[model samples]
Target: MTPPRDVAVVAYARTDHQGPAEGLSEAETLLPVLHEVLDRAGLAPGEADFTCSGSSDYLAGRPFSFTLTLDAVGAWPPIAESHVEMDGAWALYEAWVKILTGRADTALVYAHGKPSAGDPRDVLTRTLDPYYLAPLWPEPASLAALQARALADAGHTAGPDPAADPLAGPPAVADGAAAVVLAAGDAARRMCGRPAWIRGADHRVEPHALGLRDLTDSPSTRLAAERAGAFRAPVDTAELHVPFAAQDVVLRRALRLDDTVTVNPSGAAAGPLMVAGLIRLGEAAARIHRGASDRALAHATSGPCLQHNLVAVLEGDA
Candidate 1:
């Protein structure tokens, strides 16, 4: 297969992520971050060739919630834009593809969530199958606990190993938003002194039926990493979207991360729901841009029990 074009993350900005940021509307929370990333890249609002975002209406409690947040981007110019209901990592995927296609030299990606406004776990139930799982109305905690028990029964040890039990970790909640800028080749080198070039990126999904899945293993995650070329080279750092301890174990195993690779230095487990994945990607890119790591891996997950997974490999100019 042909290799994908090289696209780099030029800049990224995110909100401080208060436990449950009070008094700040979703747009209010994102506006400054929107401006900050562009300013960091020395680009004006609506200056990018394309713009995309990831968020959820279910969390926002209204239809077209994503449209409301466009006010932060100053949509007056009617720029090329798009939105995804999934985590911002997916939105970043869209923007990356656009730049790779040669249709755009630069792009902007962002994702936000006010999950603290409501029961975030309960909100997640909506992603379940309505014919079966939805009726049970099981919260994420219950599902994860079940998965953890399954892992333990299967004799999987939890730790830096891939089979760690996510349910073993403490529960946490946070509210925040994040944005990233993308540029291709020359545009990328010009925007950022040392761009974090996207070496590979891909995502995969598994059967939604929890009964059909081996809760102890994440085949989908491994598949995505393989397709994204994550194992083709050694990674110095990894920013995985591990909300629980087991997930950390599962993803590390799935991606074949060894002891030499650093994992989750930003404490992504405590970040907001819809935005954490993008933050992981952004953080990994930042480390590469700063010469902290020559190669990095970023992973994102969606759906219950890690049903869906995305992986991106980044490398420095060297």
Candidate 2:
């Protein structure tokens, strides 16, 4: 089969992460970020060949919540647009495929969430096994702690007490939005001095039953990383989307990261839902764009206990 077209991230912008965005509507939250990324990429609104978004309607307490941001970027005159209910990173994956398939030359991707508006624990519980786990109403921290405890018993250090540490637990859910701009080939080079070319990217999911999986090892993450070409060459930096600090150990082991690789310099903390993953990729790309890194790896996770994973290997032009 022919190789996919080379895709590169050209620009990125993120809002200030906070506990609550009470006064700002989704459109207000996205307008500035949309402008910044496009400006950085030298694109005006509706200029990109395609636009995609990642956001959860549950987070917004309405269906089709993502469409609310469309006007912020000027959807008038009609543009190729789509949305994902998952993290912006996945939306980025869709955009990557869009560019790879020759469907579009450029794409704008973004995501947002406001966990403070409702009971996040209750909302998260709904994502579990409907017949078995959802009834238990397990808060995300307890579930992560269970995995962290299991990992520690297997020799990895225990993550911070899931309920005790607000920063490492459910309370850390950041309320913010982020955006990234992607372009192909010379257009990418023309926009950014050092485009962070996506060498490979892949996502994988494991058995949804938590009891059926091993908490100490991230098989899905390992498989995704391998398929994404992370093992083909050593990466100098890694931006990991670990919900709990302890989970970092699992990702490191899975990705074969060494001491030479710097991790998470942006200090995402708990990271905004549906947005942190995109930030990881953007942060990794920013490092490459500024000549701080030659090669890097970025990761994102969905579902509980790293049950679903996405990994991408990125390299800067020599």
Where model 1 places Cα greater than 4 Å from the true spot, the runs are 1-3, 160-170
TM-score of 1: 0.95
lDDT tens per residue, model 2, 10-120: 999999856677788878988899999999999999999999898899877888878888879798989999999998999999999899999899999998877777777
Residue-level error in angstroms, candidate 1, position 61: 1.1
Clashes of each: 5, 0
Query: For model 2, what is the error of residue 109's alpha carbon versus the real structure, in angstroms, after optimal superposition?
Result: 0.6
Worst window of 10 by summed lDDT in candidate 1: 161-170
Q: Scored by CA lDDT, what does every candidate get? A: 0.86, 0.86
Off by over 4 Å in 2: 1-3, 158-169
lDDT of 1 by residue, 225-271 (tens): 88888888789999998767666667877889878988876664537
